[model samples]
Target: MKKIIRGWVLVFIFYMSMGTVYGTNTEALMTEKAFINELLKVSKTGAVLLTGSDEILTREKAATLIVNYLGYEAIAKKQNNLFKDVTSSQGEISLVSQLGLMNGLGSGLFQPNGKVTVSQGSLIINRIKNKLETPITWKHAFYAIQSSSQKEWIKGYDAISFGWSQLERDANNNFIISTSNTENDFKVPVGFEGPIDLAKANGVETYLMVYFENKGMLAKSFLEDELQRASVINQLVSLSQGMTKDGVTRAFDGVTIDFEQFLSSDLKELYNIFIKELKSALQKEGKKLNVAVQPTLYFKGYDYKGIGEAADHIILMAHDYGAITLTEVERQAGITTTPLTPIKEVYDALYEAGLSISDKSKIALQFSFASLQWQSQNNQVINSRAYTPSYDKIEARLSLSGSMKHFDHYLQSTYATYEENGIQNIIWYEDINSIHSKIDLAKLMGITSVSYWRLGIIPEAFNPLR
Candidate 1:
């Protein structure tokens, strides 16, 4: 009788050590059922491990399911041992940990046979599905500040490009220029002087943005004429030297060439020559040149290699791929909605830019802090407009309409839809998640700088740098 009792005690201890706990609540059971169903659909190993919805899953088995679903079972099995306590499932544990899919407990203990909690399961699932990473570290930030607002949002940044300096042509097409204000001196807008002082006070660099408007005609003509181009370059160099006021030295650190015209390959050489000459002039006065170019996928007028070598920073306007218009092929295929900056498009742009600009440090991936509203009917877009909405505005709109935002896995964008007055309204907007994902992608590609289209549109709360 003594020997039999001792044997029963040992058996009880062994069973308790297995950590076999059951999920008691209805929600837990349903979640477990759904998880098991998903696993069973993907992997055959679910047949042996997933017994019932109420049964708790061991951490080791959870790791195995993730590995199998990710098609990493064979590779997992080939890995060497990671944890000493995890003898049978060492390969799976090692693989998941290395891929950042899972982590071990303290003291080198993975608790392979321990019960997996609901939080752990949910986090692991999100890691595999969303491909999340820790917060990224960026070296520099370039912001586009609108001078009209006069609201200061340039607290912490490496540099800022601001102004509404528009390029125009007189009757003789003599390459005239103007600002957004009535009283403009040296092409400098009225309200921007204060911001330049603020930027200097905060130890942030400033760049006067030279806007090219009315398509590429004015800019192209200016570039074609050697004498006209020289005059404009000299004017820009003089503008870089800011005037002093009340014992204050206000000067721009550089000038940003925001030429967004539809120039073809024929103008590529002319573009390069203009940029080289401007860069040389700026360098003479201890200033820099920042060239904002359209993505390689859209325009071929930008000589990436030439500009990359001459300019201090090459800002890639990676947004607005399908913001305002869609191609004919897309219309025929019954596609209407488009994200402003898709993840794949950004990646492709970065890849193409990398091909020419070997120095990734000079590259700054620029995105919009705005949103696009698309009006569609019968799977055809009727009209679309882009606007910058504050965070409070977005939340208020969603709350009033009782609409929920949905995230796209492929595009890495957040969007919402609603029907009002018998018309469909689709909004593709930028939130913290969408913005951070792109920033992480840039970090992964070894690019450390990022720029926003303009400020005062996005509220101070949603500032990406913070």
Candidate 2:
């Protein structure tokens, strides 16, 4: 009877141990399932992972499903030890394919028998966040998840906590934030959506994305709205930059006169009258009545002193050292003969005019990348005319000038250089090489800032200032 009791007791103990092991395994599976459910919920709008009827999955199967649904090629490559070799050429493509994100590929690769590491999960989640395009609602939710992911280097319970933190950060970053109540009174819409779309339209999507990431969700929205408002304000301000409107009178481009010729007595009177009107118009627009006057003209013979004294900011037209004309010879000399008459001449003239510009910050330096060319024939100057030369022709001319010693040094020097004349030809105007020089000059001059002759006329590189 005692032997029988011992056998029964041993059996009971064995069963209890087995039951404990099973319960632990069950709990682990439940935790993993819950984590995956969160991912699925977040991805509801576009792509989502499938769950089974029991809604419970094995560890291996759960990892496989994540790898499959996300199209995580990296995991596969890592599993096969193929990443080191394949990553160079086909890595990005493979990774995107594995994420189930390759458009039109129809959801490839969902494995069921693989375990997922915390690092792998974080990488996958981050990629999903990046793939989401603009007008991204719930952006804050993604941010919260990212924060959790970042702190996931710790193992076990700490990893779980980090993941939860990430989710929280994402939620706060996205849905909970509110936009400002201030109305953007501009004619066009102003908000995160508008600015994001505009950036995309302008082929500056990358810049916008960077700006968005750096500023966080709320800040990005505010900045985008402010930029849009500022753009509208800038347009209105620009209209008043060189405009005169009083009663029925309207003038633009510094032109003010009746049908009479320029600078006539009627023109001067009209200019004075228009200036007063411009001031009034600007005041109404809530902009300073800033006028861009020729620095030389303002100081030359004191004719423009009164107007310069009355102006808010004197925008010195320090560029246009060379002007385009139809005369052939003037087009080939390279450097402008009227150099001293404009930039250097005008800058000095402004100083001589005795106009006390208190704020040097208001002065803007205008510079150009285009150079003049003076063409000569038989030792005599040719008329102003433009000649469009192909690369081959330019190359040939350069070679000839280099070989020939007796040719005019100026012509030789000019021939050695090339320009795209951005104002006329929309080709290569200030390349990266020339832009460095311009930036250096601007820095050296201690000028308030530099302004382009025309915004649209310059290369995209010039948009940095804007």
Q: What is the TM-score of each candidate against the true structure?
A: 0.65, 0.31
For each candidate in the order shown, give its overall lDDT on alpha carbons.
0.67, 0.33
Give the alpha carbon lDDT tens digit for every residue of 1-466 in model 2: 9999999889767654333234433112233555466557543221335554434343334444444444333324433211322323233334344333321122443232233344444455455444432221100000111222222111111001000100011333332111121231111112223322333344321110000111223322322343443442343344323222232211111111011112222234434444455444556654444344444443231224444544444445444433456344444443334321231233343343334455544444444444434444443335453333433344354465322211111111122332222222111123333333322222223333443333223334433423
lDDT of 1 by residue, 339-436 (tens): 87776677667767777898878998887666777666776665534444555666667886656787665466677777766666677877766766
Separate clash counts for every candidate: 0, 42
TM value for model 2: 0.31
- Candidate 2: deviation at residue 402, Å? 6.1
Q: Among all windows of ten consecutive residues in candidate 1, which has the lowest summed lDDT?
A: 42-51
